[model samples]
Target chain A: MTTDTTTQGTALADEIREGAGAVVLDQVAKSFRGPTGVKMVVRDLSLSIRPGEFFSLLGPSGCGKTTTLRMIAGLEKVDSGRIFLGGVDATDLPAHARNVNTVFQNYALFPHLSVFDNVAYGLHRQHVPKAELRHRVMEALALVHMDGFAMHRPQQLSGGQQQRIALARSIVTRPSVLLLDEPLAALDLKLRESMQEELKRLQRELQLTFVFVTHDQAEAFAMSDRVAVMEGGNLVQVGSPEELYLRPATRFVTTFVGRANFIPASLVEGFSASSPDEVASRQLSESPDGEESVGAEPSIFVRPERLRLEIGDSSGQIKGPRVRGTVADKTFSGGQTIVRVKINDDVELSVTCDSASNEARDASIGGAAAVTWQPSDATLLDR
Target chain B: MLGRGLRGFVALSYVWFALWFIAPSAIMLIYAFGHTAGLTQKGLVNLNHLGLGNFWQALKYPSGPVLVASLENAVVATALCGVIAYPVAYFIARKLGPRTRAIVLLLVVLPFWTDYLLRMLGWRIFLSPLGLLYNGMQAVGWHVNYLSILDTRGAVMIGLVYNYLPLFILPLAVVLERIDPLLLQAADDLGAKPWTIFRTITFPISMAGVVAGTVLVFVPMLGDYVTPTLMGGARGLMIGSLVASEFTEGQNWSLGAAMAILLVVILVGIVAACWLLATGVRYVLARARERALARVLVTT
Candidate 1:
C-alpha cells in the first residue's frame, strides 16, 4: 500500500525498511543501441519476488523476459532503475559482486575445469574453507544427481549431464536468488519434462527464491507459484497461473494464455443489458478481493473447455446464457471431442465435451446444437 | 576422409616433401653415422666406418659449451617472447573488433616483410655505440655517458625475440579468439574476478598455442646462424656458429652434420619429456581429486 501524504509515506517506508521482498525491481528499464536507433528492450517494469518463491517471467522471444533476468543477475546493466537482492541495492554492483547467480541458456560450463572445480568455483572465490567447499560442491552435485562426475571434464559429458553441472555450479553458493535463463530450452522433450520436475523438487527442498525465464507458457504455469506475463517491453499481467488463465486482465492475456471462444459485442450487449446485476455479481464473486475492475469492461469471453454442448431439449434446463445453432463440424481427440457450432454467417463458437460423454455421442454434423456456460466462468476482457 | 581432389593434393605434397626435405636430411644422417678419413677427402665422409663416433665427437670440448650456450639463448628468447606475446594476443583476440584485429595482426607481421639477414644487420647497426637508439636516448636527455650492448648476449636475445615474436602472437591470438565469450561471463556470474577468470579459464585453454609458439621460436633459436654471429661476438658463441665454422674453415663436414643430428635428438628428447610431464601432472591432479572427493564423501 502507498500513501500520498508525506508523513504516512515515511511511516509506511520505515516499517518495511529491512526489505520489501527477496528481489525487487523499481521501474527497471533497458535499451540497446540498435542500427536504426535506440531500441527499448524493457520499459518501466516494477516487480517483487517473494523469498523462497518459485517465480517465472513468461513471454515470447524478444519480449524482454531474458533481458529482465539478465538485469536481475547483474549481467546486463539497467538503463534507469534499482534492483535489490536480499534487501541490498544491487543496481550498481558488478556481476561478480552480486549475491545472485544464473544458469545460462547454453549451460556455459568451464571447459578447462573438472565438474567438481566448476561447481566449487563460487565457493573458491569466496575463499570458503577447503573442506567446507568440497562438502558443499559434492552436496550440490548430489542434488543434481551428478555426484559421480566430479572428476570428468565438461567436454566429456552429455548435454543433460552438462545441464545438471551448470545447475549445480549456480546453486552451490546458495545465492539470494537463483536465476535461470531458459536453462532447459535446448533439451529434448523427455529430458525437459524430467528436468521440470527435478527443478521443482530442487526449489522446494532448497527453499531458495527462483526467478525462472521461459517463453513456454505451459512450462512456466506448470512449475511457478507466480507467473509474470510480459509483452512488448511491458508487464501485461502478474498472478498465479490459475488466475491468469481464468481471469485474464487484458485481451493479449486472454488469447495468449489459452484458447478463447468469443461472444461478439452484439450478443454480449443483449445478455448484459437483460442481466446487468447477474453479470456484476458473477464478476464480484469470482474476484472477491476487489480485482473486478481489473477486467474493465464486460466482454463475453469463454474458454473452449467451459463451453457446454448439448444435442436437444436438455439445453433448455441449463442454468446460464444459451444459444441454438447448427453443428458445423466435430473432431475427436482421444480425451475430448470438439464441436463447432455455426450461430450465424458471421459468428461461430467452438465447444469441447468429454469424448465418451453422451453430448459428444449425440452431436452430429449439420444437426441442431446448443451451447451454454456457467455464469461464474464468464470473463470480461479489459478494454 | 579427405575428398578425391584433396587426397590427390595430399599425395602431391608428400612427393614434394620427400624430394625437397627427405633427400637432404637422409644425406646428413648418413654423414652423422660415418667418419672422415684422409687429408684429401677431409671435408667428405668415409662410409666404411659407420658408427656413433661423430655424435660423440660433436659433444666433446669446445662444441659442448657452444651447444649449452645455444640452448640457454633459446630458453631465454622463447620465454621472453611468450611473456610479451600473451597480453598483446589476448587484447587483440578478446577486446578488438574483427576489423581492428586484422589491422593489429598486419602490424605484428609487418617486420617479416624485410629480409631476415637485413633485419639482423639492422639490429647490429641500431645497437652500435653511435647508433640511432643511442642518439635518440641522448636527445631525450637520459643521464647516460656510455651506451654499448652491441657485442653481447643481451643484444642477441633482443634480436631473437624481435624476430620470433610475431610467430608466438599469431598462434596464441588464434586460440584466444576461438574461446567462447560465454565462458568468461559464466565465470563472472560464478563470482570470479577478472584475473581469476583469466588464470582459471582463459590461460589454460590457450596452452596449445603456448606450446606451439614455444616450439616455433625455440627450435629455430637452437640453430640460429645470424644473430649470435653478429651480436654474440666471441664470448657469446653458440653451437650454430661452431657448426658453421667446422664446415667452412675447419673442413670437418662429418662433425658439422653430426652436430645437427645431435640437436635433433636433444629437441626430440625435450619434447618427449614435456609430454610425459604433462601426462604425469594430469594423472596426479585426477588422483588428488578422487582422494579429495572421497574424504568429503566420508565426512558428509
Candidate 2:
C-alpha cells in the first residue's frame, strides 16, 4: 500500500492500516524455570484476534494471561507452535522486529526523556525524517490530549498522564497490533474508567487490533469486543460479555466473570424445564405426602441479581423455581441490598435486590423468605 | 542547647582537625612562599624570610615538565580504569544473580584486604627480571623482554590501574544495578534494538557513575607517590616523588612545600572543573524544566 508521508494524520492512519493484522496463535506454550522446578505458565494456548478488534485476555493473576499477551508481542518466546501476524510466521522474530507494541503495566516511561521524545522514540527507531517524526509525535500527543506537556519529563507527570504518554509512545509507531498488559492496572479507579473509554476510542479510530490482558473482568468486559477467559494456563471460554455472563460454559467462568450462586442439582427440581411456581407447587404437594425427588447431575449457576427474594410464602405465584429459606444476612450496599439465604443446613444462596424495592427493605436477618429464579435465568453446568 | 557530651565531642574533633590537618597546611603554605637558604644557612632554615621565589623556581622548565608528566600519567590511568571497569560492573549488576553478584563484588574488593605497600611490593616482584611472570612467559614460548618491562611507565600505569580498579567498579555497579530492567523492555517494545537501547537508555543513565568513578580514581592518582617510586625507576619522577625527594634526600623543604602547594592548586582546579561540569549539566536540565513549565503555563 502506498502512503502519503506529507499529511500527518493520513500517514499515521495509512501506516496502521497497512501494518494492522489479525494475530493468530497456533498451539503456543510457554514455561518458566522457577526456584522449585519447571512450571508451565501457558499451555497449548490458541486464539485469533481479528483486525481492528479489541480482544481481552481475562483471568486471575498467574493464570498466564500476561504470558500469552507477551508471546504475541514477541516479548516471550513460545516453547512450541507458531504465531502469525498479518498471515506471516513471526514465532522467531525478536520483539523489535515484530510489528507489535505493548503498553507495560508500570507505564515504563523513560525517566531520562521528555514526553515528546518518549512518544517519538518508535518513529526515531524507524529513522523517519525529523519533521515527520515531530508531526506524528505531536499528533499522538494531541490525540491523548497531552500536547501541552510535551517538554515535561515522564517523572514530572502524574500516573494517569504517564499512562497516556505510554499509550502515545506505543501507538505512535502504528504497529500492526497493540498489546496492553494491564495498562490501566496502575491507575486509580476513576482514571482507569476514563482511560478505558479513551482506549476504546483510540482502538476504533486507529483501526488496529488490540490484545489487552487484564485480571479485572469488569474492565475487560467494558472494553472488549470478545473476551477470552483463562484459568490455570488454559483458555476456559471466549465469547461476548453478555454471552459469557448469561451462559457461562463452566463453573470457573460463572464465578470469574461475575458473582454467582452455585446450588446442588439435587435441590433444584426440574430446574431446566419447569417454572419456579410449578416446581415449588409440586415440591409443596410432595412435601405434604413426605415424598420429594431431587434430581441428580447438572448444578445450577445463577447470578446474584437473577435470584429474587420475596417475604412470606409466595412460592405459588413466583414464575420460576422457588426454595424456602431464612435470611441469614442482609447487607445494604447503597444502590442494592445483598441478602444471603439459607435454603438447607448446608446450602446458602445470595440474592441481590434493589435497595429502593420493598422486598429488599423487608429482608431482615432471621426472617423467612423464598428465593426464586426462572429456569432460563440459571445456567445448568456439569461440574 | 547542645548536650554536654556532644559539645565535648565536637570540640575534640575540631582540635584534632587543627592539630593534624590545619597545622600542617598552614606550615606548608608559609614554607611554600619562603626562599631557600644557600650553603651558609643550611636546609631552608630561613623560615622568617618569605617571598614568591620558591614558586617561581618550582614553575621553571625542569619542574614544570615533571608536573605535566605526572598529570598525564594520572589522566591516562584514570581513563583506562573507567574503560575497563564499566563492563565488569555491568556484568556483575545485570547478568549475575544476587549470590553470584555478592561473590563477584567480594572478589573485586579482595585486594583491599592486603596492605597497599604489600600489594605494590607484590607487583614489583611479579614484574622483576627473574620474576614468575617472565618464567611463565618463557614456559609459554613467548620471548618477552624482561629488562624493558620492569620499573617503566607501563609498570606504573599497571600499578595505578590495579590499585584503583575496585574503586571505579563499585560505584558504577551500584548505579547500574538501580536501573529498572523494565525500562529496557519498554525500549525494546518501542522498536529499539539492543545497541540502540544501550546508546539511548543505558549509557546516558549510567553517566553519573562514570563521573563519580572518574573522580574517585583520578583524585588519588594525582598525588600518588609510592606506585611511581616503586614501578617507575628513572622515568618515574612524578610531582609526588619529587616533593618526597626534596623533603628527604635533596633537603630542600621550601622547594618541596612549593611543589606541594602547586599540586594542591592543580587538584583544586580539577575538582572545580568537575564541579562546573556537574553544575552545567544541572543548569541545562533546570532550563529544560523551566521551558517545560513555561509551555505548560502558556497552554493553560
Candidate 3:
C-alpha cells in the first residue's frame, strides 16, 4: 500500500488500502436511561468495514443501524468497545477529528453556505491552499454532476440535488470511510432511482469505503458489496446479497428481504417430507436440542418465484415436495402472472409464471392446482 | 342574521374604543403646537406662528446642564448593558438544553419581581458609606471613597443598567433561540473552526437581536428619571429630570409639553433607525440568498 509518498504529502489514497485506513468496531454497545432505567439500544455489536468496500447495514427502524454508523463517524459516544480507524484508537475522538464523514438522512447541509463553500469547508479546515481547494471542490462536485451548483445554497436545491451535494461534500474530504445514513429516503421515486445509480458510480470512481444504512432491501441489494441484516439491535445475517437471498440464516431475514411462504415439513432421512401433525409433534419433542439447526423444521421457507405450477391431481403423484392447492387469485403483470394458491389447510402461497405459460396451464381463480418445488429450494427455518 | 348583527355591533364597539384611546393623545398634540400664554390657547393648530419658541426655550432653560448629563448617562449605560447582556443571553440560549435553559432564564428575570424603587434603594444601601460593603472594606483595612457612589454619574449609570438589563436579554435570547445548532455544525463540518463558525454564522445572524435589544434597553433608558434622581444626586440630572422639573417645579406647562415632544421625537427616531437597521440586515440576507440561487442556477 506504500505508494509514491515522496511527491504527495502523506498519500491518503494509498494509505487507505491494505487495511491501513480500515475501520474496525469491537463489541460496541449503546444504552439510554429510560423510564424503566438503562435500556440498551445496540447490544454488543462488532463489525469491520474494509477499505474500498461498500457495506450496508440493513434493518428495520430502531434496529440501531444508524447508531452504529454514528458511532463509527465519532458522532455518538460508544458505551463500551473500541473503534479503530487506520489502526488508531478513535473511540474517544470527536466527529470532526475522525477520518470519516457522514451524509445524514436529512442531508444536513449548511443553509447559510453556498454549495461551493459547503464542499470547500473541510478542505479549508485542512488549510489546503485556496486555488487547490477550489479545484478539489469543483472536481468532487463534478463527480456528482453538481459542479455548476457550487454557489447555490442548500435550501434552493431540490431533494435529489441536495443529496448529491451532501455526497460531494463528504467525498471531497476523501475520508477513509464515507457513511450514508438513509440518504435517499427523502427522494421521490424517479429521483431515488437516478441517485441510486449515481451513488454506485461515485463509490466505484472514488474507490472509497462506503457504509450505507437503509431499511430498503432493494437498495441494499443494489449497491452493497456485502449486506448486514439486523433485527432487534442484533446482526441476524451478514453476507453477500445472493448468499442472503438463496440461504437466509433465519426466518426473519427471509421475510425481511422478500416474501416467503412457510410450509410445515419433516426432515425424514435427509429429505424434508410433508409430515402430518402427529409425526411433527413427535419430531418436535425428540429434536428439542436441535433448535439452532437450520433443518429443524415444523416449517420450510420457499420463495414465490421458485415454485413450479402443475395441472391438477399431481399432489400425491409428484416425486418430490409438492402441495395441492386451488388458485385463490391471479394478477397480470405484463411479463409474468402472479398466482396466489390456497392449500388444503387454507394456507396461501404466491407463485409466479410466465404469462404465456400461465395461460397454457389454464390456471385461474378457483382452479385446483399443484405447486411443486425441490427440497433444495425450500430452506428449513426455525419458525 | 342575529349572529352577523352581533358581530357588526362588536366591530363598532372596537372602533369606538380605538377612538377613545386616540382622543387624549390627539388633544395633547394639538395643545403642544398651539400658542399658549400659561393656560390660554391663542389659536387652534397654529404652529407656524409659534415657530419652535417653546422647544428653543425648553432647550435653553435652566442652563441645559440636566439635559447634557442625562443623555450622557443613558448613552454610557445602554452601551454597557448591551455588552454585558449579550454573552449571558447567548450562553443561555445556545449552550443549555430546554430544562437548564428555562432555569437559567428564570434566574435572569427573577430580580424583576421586586419593586424597582426597592431594588435601587438596595443598591444605594449596599454602596453607602456605613453600608455592609463599605464596612467590610473598612474591616479589611482599606479606605474606599463613599462619595464616588452615594450620588454620582457612575451610580446612575449602574442603576439604569440594572433597571433595563432584562429588557435587553429577553429579545437577545429570543433571536439566539431561533439560531439552529445544525447551522454551526454545518460550518464546523465544512472546515470552519469553532471561532470561524461563530464569526461567520452565529454573530451575523444575531445582529437583528443586538439591534432590537439595544433599542429595548436604550430608548427607555433615555427617558428614565427615578434612577438618576435617586442615585445621581445633583450631577446625575438627565433629560427626563429636566422635563420633570419644568412641569412639576418650574410650573412651565408649555415648556414641559415642548420638551416632552422632543423626547417623543427622539424615541421615534430611535425606532425608525431600528426599523431601517432591521430592514437593511434582511435585505443583505435576501441578496445573499438570491446570489446563492443565481450561482446554483449558473452551475447546475
Candidate 4:
C-alpha cells in the first residue's frame, strides 16, 4: 500500500455494492462524564441492519439515538461493543479510516469551499482521477438536482440548497453506510416534507444503506424500512412501521408512535404467546367479559383513527367491544376533527372523524354516544 | 435614518478625534515643512521659509538606512511572533478542555497587566554580562560570550518578541476559537486525515486571525522606540531612536517631524505593496483552479 500511492488511492475507492454494506452493532454502550458524574447515554444496544435498508433510530432528544448513530459512523466510540461494517470490525477505527460518511445537522458544508469542491471533497481524499472526480461529482450534484449551483459557496445557497449539497457530498464517496443525523431538521415544514420524499427516492435509487437518526417519529415512519424506537437509553422496540404502529409492545411505544387511546384493562388467562398470530387469535376468541375477570392489570391501546362513534337512534348492531360515554370535547381540525368521548369514570377516548361528515358537524358536546372499535385494533401492552 | 441620540454620539466622537488626532497631525505637518531657527528666537520653527528640503533630508543617507533597518527588524519580529503564536493559539483553542482553556488564556493576558518598562528592564538584566542567563549558560558547559551578546540586535529582537507576543496571541486565539469544530468533524467524516483537515479547513479559516495578529504586532513594533533604546547600544539603533534623539538631545524638531512623516509613508507603502502582492497571488491561484476545473469539465 505504501509503494504505489495512486493505486492505493484508487483501491480505497471501492463503492458499496448491493449486498455487502451491512452494519451490525453488538452490545454497544456509551457514557459521558457529565457535570454530575459518569452518565450512561446508550445502554447495551444491539442490532443488525440489512444491506440496502433504510434504518432509523427514532427517539426523543437525549435518548442516545444520535450517540448510537455516531458510534456506528465511528465519530463516537462505543464504551464496550463491537461494530462491524461490511463484515469488518470497525469499533476501533477512526471516522476517516472507516468506510462511512455522515450528513450532519445544519449541513456542515465547508463554508470556504464552493459547492463543486465540497461535493468533490471525499473523492479528492481518495485521490480519484481529476476527470473521474469531476464526472462523479457532477453526477452526484445532478442526483440532488444541485448541478446549477456547483460554483456557488455553501453560505450563498439557501437552506434547502445547502441540504442538497450536503447530501451530494456524503454520497459522493459511496460509503458502505451513510449516517444522517437529523439532516432535515433545520429546514422549514414544506421543505422538510419535500426533502423527505426526495431522500426516500434517493435511498431507493442508490441502493445504499442509510442510517437515519431523528427525533420525529412521523419522519421515521415516512422514510424507514425498519425503525428502532429508543427511550431512556434503552431499545424499546424494533419493527416495521406498520407492525410497530399496530402492535406496540409497551406504554411508551403505544403513545410515542401515534396518538393512542389507552383503556385500563387486563389480559385474559392462558394467552402466553407474544407473536402476531397469538394476538389476532386471542382478539377473535375472547369476549369483553374476559377483560373484567382477569386478576393482573394491563393497558389496552387503540389508535384514534380505529374508533368509530355511534350517536343516538342507531339501529345498527355493535359487533365489537364498545364503550358507552358522553362526548366530552370536540376539536375541529381541518380534514379531521377529534371528538373526546368520556367513558366509565374519567376514561376519555378520542375518536377521529372526517370534519366534513354530518356526524362530526352535528355531534354536540356532552351528547350520549357509543365509541366502538375492533378488538384486533387494540394491543395489550406492558407499562 | 439615524436616531437623535446616536447622531449626537457620532458627532461627539468625531469632534474628539479631530481635537486629539487631527490637531497634532496638523502641527507635525507644519514642522515638517518649516525649518529650525538658528539665532532668531521666533519659536523652534522658522515659518518664513518652508520647503520640501527637510523631507528629502530625512529620506537620504543616514536616516534612510536607519528606517530600512527598522523596517527589517519589525518585519522579522512580526513574522517570528506569528510563527510562535499560531501553535499556542491553536492548542488553546482546539486541544485544551474548557476549564483549562480559560486558565491558559488568563496566563497569556497576565503579562499585559504588568509594567511594560519593568519587563524590558528585566530582559536587560537577563542579557547582561553578570546576569542569571549568562551564568546559567556558562554552568551548562557552553563557553558562550555575553560581552558580544549584550546590547546587540539579537537582544533587541528578543525584547520586541517578548513584549508584543500577547498582542499576537489574543486576536488569533479568538478567531481560531470561533471556527466551528463541526466543520472539522464533517471533514473527518468525509475521509480527511487530521493533517488534511487542518490543511484544508482549519488553516484557511485561521488566516483571518493570522492577518489580524500580524497587524496587531507589526504596526506597534514600527512605532516602538524603547526596546531599541535600552537593548540596542549603537549598532542596533533603529529609526525610532533617531527620531527620539532628534526631538530631545539634538533638539531638531523639524527634522524629527520630517522623519515621522517619512516613516508613515514607508509604512503605508509597505502595506499597500503587500496587499497588492497578496491579491495578485490569490487571483493567479484562483485562475489556475478555475482553468483546471474547466479542463475537467471539457473532458467530462
Candidate 5:
C-alpha cells in the first residue's frame, strides 16, 4: 500500500512538473539607478536551466549572479527581455505568483516563526489540507535532519540549523526551480563544506532543479552539474567544472575557476615571438585556409599542479617545453605546498606539489630550479 | 573592591531617587493625610488633624466626573493617535529611502523644538472663535459658527491627539524599521500574498511598537492640564484642571494631593491591565496554535 501511494505521489508530482516548465532567460537585462547614475547590473544574458539539474551562476560580487537568480525567482524585473517558466512567460509575474523559491544568503528564516510554521508557510498559502501540510512539513524537516526542531524558533537555532530550516522551508513548497543565493555563505568553513554535500544530496533525493548563486568557485564547482560563469553583467562562459577548468575560453574564466600560470608565448621556444595582437591577426588570417590556426599574441596557461619542479637538468627526460628559473618563494599549506619560481626578471610561475612529495620537501627558497609540463597540459589563449 | 564600588553606586542612586522622587511624594502623602488649620500659613499642615476628609471630598460627584471625563478624552485621543500614526510610521519605515526617512523622522520631532505650553497656546488661538480654522471653515460656506467648537470635548481630544501624535510615531517607526526586509522577501517567496504577509508577519511583529506607542501617548495624555485648560472652556473640565484648582484657586492642598494620588493609582492600574491583557492574549493564541498542531499531528 505504501509503495502504491509513493508511486502515485511521484506520478502526480511529475504531472505538476510538466505543467511547471523549465526556466528560460531570454536576453534579460536589468539596471539600478544609483548616485553615479543608472548602472547596468545585468546585460543581455540568455541561459536555460534544465529540469532536475544542479545549475549554478558563479561570479564575484557585483557580477550580476544574484541579480540573475533574483530575476529567475521574479523578485527582480527585467528592464528588457522575457522570462519563461514552465513554457509560460513569467517576466511580469509577481514573486508570490511564480512557482520558484529562494534560500537567501542569510537564511532569511522568519525569526518570529517556529521551524514547522516556517516550512508549512507556502502550504498554508495554498490552503493545503492541514494533515497533509503537517506530514509534508515533517518530511521536509526530516530531509534536512531538523525534524526534532519543529517547535523551536529560528533564533533559537545555530547558524547551520537555521540554514537547514531555510532549505526545508524552500523545498517544502516543492518549487519547480529552487534558487539558492549563497545559502551557505554565512556558515563557517567546516559547516559550509558539510552543508554543500548535504544540499547536493537533498537536491538529488528530492529530484528538484536547483539554480545556485555563489562567488565561491569551489562551492559552485563542487555541486553544480553545469556552471555559468558571469563577469561585469555579461555571461563569460558556461560549462561543466572540468571543462571550464581545463579549457577556459577567456582569461577571466581561466583565473576565476582555479589558479593558472600565464606565460607569454614568446617565452616558449619554437613559437614565433610576436605581439599578442599580431599573432591573433595571423591566426585569423590563416583560419580560412583549412589549417589549424595558432593563437595570435598567444599566452600559455598551465595549472600550478600540472607544473613539475626539478632540482637539476631533467629536460631530457621531460616530454614538453622546459623553463629554467630560481625558486622565489615557497608556502606550505597542509595538503599541498606552493612554490613560486622567477623565470625572468619580469615573469614568475607558481608550481603546486603535494606536501609529502620529495621535490616539494627538498625545494628551498632562492634555490635554482627548472619547471616543465606536457604540451597538452598547457592551454594557448589570445592575450 | 568591586562589590564596595557597586554598593556605593547603588547608594548614590538611592539618594538621587529619594531627593527627586521620594521626597516630593512623601510631602504629598503627608498633605493628603493631614489638614490645614484655617490658613495660618500656605504651606503649613496640622498633623494632629489627620483624617480621610480630603480623600472623601476628592472622590465626590464633581471631582469624580472630572476624572471620568479626563479618562474618556485621553482614551479617545490615544485611540485616534494610534489609528492615524500607524500608517505614517509604516510608510516612513518601509517605503522611504534612508535620506527621506531621516528627513521625515526629523519632521516628526520638529514640534519638540517649541515649548509645550507655547504649542498649546498656539492651538488655543488656532481653534478660537475667530481663529484660522474657524474663519477657514466659514470661508468655505459651511455656515459653522466661529469659536463655538472651542472649549468642548472635541477640542480637548484634538489637542491631546495633536500633542501626542509624535510620541506615538517615533516608537512605532523604531520597531517597524528594525524588522528585516529579507523576512518579507522570504514570505513572498513562500507564496504569501501581500495582505496575508502583512497579517501574519508584519502585524504580529509590530505589536511591540503598537503597545509601546500606546503607553507613551496614553500615560502622558491622561495627566495633561495645559491643552484642557487652554482649549477646554467650561464643558471640558478634567482631573488635571480639577487638581490644579484644588491647589491654586481652592487652596486645598490636601485635597489636590489626594486627587493626584488617585490619578497615579488609576494610571498604574491601566498600565498593569494593558500588560496583563497583552500577555494573556498571546498565551491563549499560542495555546490555540499548539492545540491545532497537536490535532493535525494526531490525525496524520
Candidate 6:
C-alpha cells in the first residue's frame, strides 16, 4: 500500500498539536522522591492519540502506564511536559478542571451514592439542569447496558456491575478522552471477558477516545485498535494490534505482547552490508521492486499458533527452513494443545496445535516431533 | 453444681460479688418505694407498696424549683460535647498520618489523665480577671468582664464539655479507622463535590461512631455536679447536683433514688434506640444489594 503522505504528516504534526478529542503529550517525565532516592517513574515520553481512537498502553507493573495516564487525566503532575486536551494547554489544569474522567483499577465508584447519583455528580458540579442530568446519566448507563441499575449503590452491585457503573460515571460527562487504568483487572476471568466486550461496544456507541492502561497483552490486543507497548518507562513500539503482533519492532515488544519462540538464525543470504536491522528485506528479497533491507545473524520470532507440528520419521529435524525439536511436554487445552519442545541446544520452544486431531492426543511426551512454519510466518526481528 | 463442695464455694463467691455491687442500688430502690419509717426496721422486713409520691416530690422539689431543668441542662451539655468532639476525632482518624495521629490523640486524652479538680480549677482561673485569656482579650481592645463567665451556665457547660470531649473522640476515632478510604474516593469519582462527599459518604458511614461518642460524652455529662458547683454556681447545677443535694444537704435519700432510677431508664432507652437505627440501616443496605443481585440474575 502507498503511504498516505498527508495522513503521516497529520499524525506527525499532531504530536505537538491538539484538537477536539485529540491528546498530545510532549516529552513528559515524572519522578518521585522515594525512600531510597529520587526515582524516575516516567522518563521523557512523547505520544499523540488521535481523536475517537481506542488507544491502549500495554506494559507490566512499574512500566509507567498508570503514571502516563494519570498525567493525561491531570491526577499526577508532570515533571516536564506539555499536555494538551482538546486543543487547550492542560498540563497545569487540576483534575476537576480537565474534561477527562478515569475508571481506576478499583473502579472507585462512590459507595454512598446510587448509580444514578454517581453518574450525575460531574453534571451537577457543572450546574447542569436536573432533567438533563438525569437524561444524560441514563443515556450513559444505557450505553453500558446498566440502565436498570440507576438507583443501586456501588456496593450493592457485583464487580462487573460496579465496573459498568464506573464507566457510566465517566462517560456521563461526555469527556473528550476517557482514561481507564486496568478497569477490568479486579474481575474474575469470565466477568472480565464479558466486561471487555461490553467496554468495546460502549466505546463504539459513545464514539469517545479511550486511553486504556493494562499489563494483560491478550486484553490489550483483543480490544485496542492501536497498542503502545511500554517497558521500563520507555515506549517500545506503537502500532495496530495486528502490526505489533506480526512485525514487532523491538525484542521487548515480541516477548511482551505475545508468546514467541526465538531461535538463533544465521543469515545464509540476502543481508546487505548497510541497514543491518531490517527484517522486511529478507522476506521481500525475491520481489525485485521491494524496499526493505535484510540483516545478518538475526533472531527469528515464531508465534506458537504459526508452527505446524507433524509426526514422522524425519522428526527432531527441520524441513523447509523449520527447526527440529523433541516434545518435552504437551498440554491439552480446550480446542488447542500446547506442546513444549526442545528447539535448539539449551533452548525450549512452546508450540500450539489444533486439538481436533487424534494424532496430537496419541502423541506422547519425550518423543521426537518435527515443527515447521513458512518463511513468512517466521519474523526475523533484529534485537 | 451447688450440690458439690467446690461448686458451692464458687457459687458463694459469685453471689458475694454480685451482692457487693448490687447491694446499695437494691437498698436505695427499696427505700425509695417504702415509707420513711422503713429504714429503721432493717433486715428486709416491712416492705411497703410502690408509689409515685417520691417521683412527684422529686419533680416538685423543695421551693418548687423544677428539677427537670438540671437534667435538661446536662443532656444539652452532653450533646454539645459530642458536636465539638466529632471534628477532632475525624481529623485524628482520617486526616492525620500515623505519627501525627498518635500525637494528636495523646493531646486529646492528656487532659482527662490530669487531676480532674485541678483542671476545673485551671478553667476557673482562666476565666478570672488576672488569667491569660482575660488579659489577652483586654489588650485586643474588647470591653470584657473576665469573671462574668464563671459561676454561670456557660462556664458549667464549657467545663463539662472539656472534661468529656476525649471520651467521645477516642471511640469515634476507632470506628472511623475501620471505614475504607476507597469509599470516599468512590464518592469523588462519582462526581460528588467535596462537601457532598463528606455529607453523604463520610458523615453517614461515621454515624455509628457518633452514637458511641455521644453516649460516652453525654451520659457522663448528665451526672456531673462538681464542675457545676465549682464553675457554674447555683444556676449551673445539673441533675447530679440535684441527686447529691437530696441525699447530703436536703437529707432526702428517697427523692435522690427516684431521680437516679429515671436517669438509668432514659440512658437505656437511648442505647436501645441507637442499636435499632444502626441495624435498620444495615438491613436496608443489605436488601438493596439483594434486589440488585436478583435483577442481575433475572437479566442473565
- Per-model interface RMSD values are 0.9, 3.8, 4.5, 1.5, 1.8, 5.7
Predicted model with the maximum DockQ: 4
* lDDT by candidate, in order shown: 0.83, 0.85, 0.76, 0.84, 0.84, 0.75
User: Against the hidden reference, what TM-scores do the models get?
Assistant: 0.86, 0.87, 0.82, 0.92, 0.90, 0.80
Native contacts matched by each model? 0.88, 0.67, 0.29, 0.77, 0.77, 0.29
lDDT of 5 by residue, B66-148 (tens): 89889999999999999999999999999999999999999999999999889888888888888888888788887765567
RMSD of each: 7.8, 5.3, 5.9, 5.2, 4.3, 8.3
TM-score: model 5 vs. ground truth? 0.90
Best by TM-score: 4
- Report the error of model 5 at residue B140, Å: 2.0
- Give me the runs in candidate 2 sitting further than 4 Å from their true place: A1-11, A267-297, A313-316, B1-54, B61-63, B144-146, B245-258, B274-300
Worst 10 residues of 4 chain A by lDDT: A272-281
Model 1 ranges with Cα > 4 A deviation: A1-21, A262-300, A309-333, A337-351, A357-383, B37-44, B143-146, B230-237, B244-251
DockQ of 2: 0.49
| Clash count, candidate 6 | 3
Give the Å error, residue B94, model 3.
Answer: 4.5
lDDT tens string, model 2, A1-383? 01222244454667688764799999999999999999999999888889989999999999999999889888888999899999999999999999999999999898888898899889999999865676677778877888778888899999999999999999998898999999998889999999999999788778889999999999999999999999999999999999999888788999999999876554344323222334644433232112224453445667999988888666456665687879999888999999999888767999999999989988888988988876557665654
Which residue pairs show collisions in model 1? Answer: none
Off by over 4 Å in 3: A1-21, A268-296, A310-319, A331-337, A344-346, A355-366, B1-32, B39-50, B54-72, B94-97, B139-142, B145-147, B175-179, B183-201, B244-300
Give, for candidate 3 chain A, the lowest lDDT window spanning 10 residues: A1-10
| Residue range B169-212, candidate 3, lDDT tens digits | 88999899998776665555554667877887888778778888
Docking class of 1: medium
Candidate 6's error at A315, in angstroms?
A: 7.2
Cα lDDT, model 3, residue A51: 75
| Local accuracy of candidate 1 as per-residue lDDT tens digits, A160-270 | 899999998987776767899999999999999999999997776666788999988899999999999999899999999999998888888888888887664322232
User: Candidate 5's error at B177, in angstroms?
Assistant: 2.8
Model 4 DockQ vs. reference:
0.70
